[model samples]
Target: MSTIKARALVLEEPGTQPVLAEVDVLDPGPGEVRIKIAASGVCGTDGHAIEGTHPLARWPIVLGHEGAGVVESVGEGVTGIGVGDHVVCALAVPCGTCRQCRRGLAEHCNSAARRQAMSGVMADGDSRLRYGGERAYPFFGVGTLAEYSTVRREQVIPIDPALPLDEFCLAGCGVITGYGAVMNVARVRPGDSVVVLGAGGVGANVIQAARAAGASTIVAVDAIPEKLELARTFGATHVVEASADVAKEIAAIEPDGADAVFEVVGKPELLTLCLSLTRVGGACVMVGIPPVGSKITFDAFTLTANRRLLGCRGGAVVPARDIERLVSLYRGGTLNLAGLIGRRIGLDDVFGALDALGKSTFARSVVVF
Candidate 1:
């Protein structure tokens, strides 16, 4: 294939909007590879970056994290990956040399964090995008919004060539976030009861993961009827439409409340409700990113009853390992990744797709290249 210029949606300012612009992407450098993006999924975090709400972002940046593509070129020192290899981009690129990585916490690798966030050129770091002799930062380090990206070799994980790119693109973020939460973070046991609040893309995976973990009762709660319907397909044995009586409905099923309640909505009231729905000694995991300064208040007595409140980041996942496992589950027909893809659009239609996602509960819209 001939070298081609790529278009990327980049944020010019904080709290504004992103605009599509042409950019120059370099060939891979040492330990790097250039990927021809086949599909990119719009994630909630991308929305946050667009709104300039993410604490980890810098302006005049390219924002996109969920990406899947084919390897186009590999830099020196790269191995095991070759041109035409189908792969999914991972957000956390771990440097095994970091202190945290050595402790078996590669997700928290300080070196990787510095490198990925600093890789953006306009943001006072290395970068792959250039405009009129100026640099542009790639959000979350991958900048999958573009048609091509040169990223760290460790950031790409090969997937089954048989899996369609459009559908599995979501495995990069939402799918793995929820699925990993249940399988890795919670380690949910068989016969356990799970209450997942918010049946969005991530929430649905939580339901399916719980089912795969052999949870007996998977309760899905969402205000949208369509999402509740989707929850059933993913393994929710019981669905509760959100209302004032939601707690009552949930309590009727599990009189002592559920063993685990996941608050995926990120709203204060919803989180409080999730806390109320957890049985004594049960765990309540918060997976959503709430607005700045958002906090929840509850009675000390209730919290003292051995009720655990936990926060899960990146689904408490190590993407390289967990994503492969998830892909295996998908291949085995255990994880419903294809079903999570709500719609598919071309790059030219990405703006409209993003608008629709904000206005409606589009589980995920894949931008097929």
Candidate 2:
């Protein structure tokens, strides 16, 4: 295979700052496609990987998974997708043979083959990138931070070329996670009440998705007033400034408590607290990415009422089906993707954006190629 040189943001190790370095990118192999990234959304997961917190994080990895771009090349046996097709790089690629996949729970697919891909290795157990003569893995197997990335066929989802790549890139992760949490995981129905904690990048989408699901009352909770205000634009019917009385505030909005509560803040204590806010038979979905190995306590009585506490990994996203639905919704004016973008920056400004993950923020900072 031929190799080409490209600049990528490489995280050499945990707790170290990522640097832009020119690296070698190998040509796509069988069942692989090379993508020329046009834009990528800077996400909290990237920050977590840089800090060695994400469970599937790997060292010496190229960062950035929420990317949309054009197909640059395709390898042997690759069909239906070819060079020049605009696509979004998907984070979850399920191995169809796995029990989880066959059972239609592809988002939770844990096959060894899928895990290897999640760790940034191809089917051959090798990396497509090399930095300073050493192998470098791609974060989440897509590595959209680079100008070019080679990924498995399932990871590259073709999209409508008319949609703006910068805004659509978010469909790969943040959008899909938030949207799918309500539509796929929690299954919030029309006239239901929803409570979304943390009005950040993904939280905002969760707020909107709840609205799309036709939730009658959407209460967005965040300590930042700016985010609470921004949450309204995305469909939060009411806003609550996070404090000791968050549950009380949510109760005021929904007397019996919300039908569904989403803990987007990823705090363990909050997970337990949010669980308490669900009605007797309501569901509480934890949509945040907690630190790997972090533990949370559940009040045993919380479940006696039939209140459900569920974990959402990437919104239980089934890539092939969900990505297409997202594009359609965006095109139909049903999904507000533009509202999710806070600012657009170049690759040079990624460090500033990456460091802003946990801080008070409402929208996403996308890196446009």
Q: Return the top candidate by lDDT.
A: 2
Q: For every model shown, what is its TM-score relative to the native structure?
A: 0.93, 0.98
lDDT tens digits, residue span 1-369, model 1? 334479888788777867888878876777778899999998778888877777778667777889999999988888999999999988766667778888998766668454654344322246766654577667777889899988877778998788888877888888888987788676789999999998887898999999999999999998888888989999999999886498999999999988889988767667788889999998888888887777788876778989888877778777789998987898788988778888887777778766765345647788888
Error of 1 at 2 (Å): 9.8
After superposition, which runs of candidate 1 have C-alpha atoms over 4 Å from their true positions? 1-4, 108-124
lDDT string, candidate 2, 1-369, tens digits: 478788899999999999999888899999999988999999988988888888777779899999999998899999889989999889887898989888877778979998888889999889888999999999999998999999999898898788899999999999999998999889999999999988998999999888888899999999888898999998998999886498787777788888999988778778887887889899999999888788998778889999988989899988889989887787778899887888899999998998788784657999998
The prediction achieving the highest TM-score against the true structure is 2
Question: Candidate 2 regions off by >4 Å?
Answer: none
**TM value for model 1:** 0.93
Local distance difference test scores for all models: 0.81, 0.89
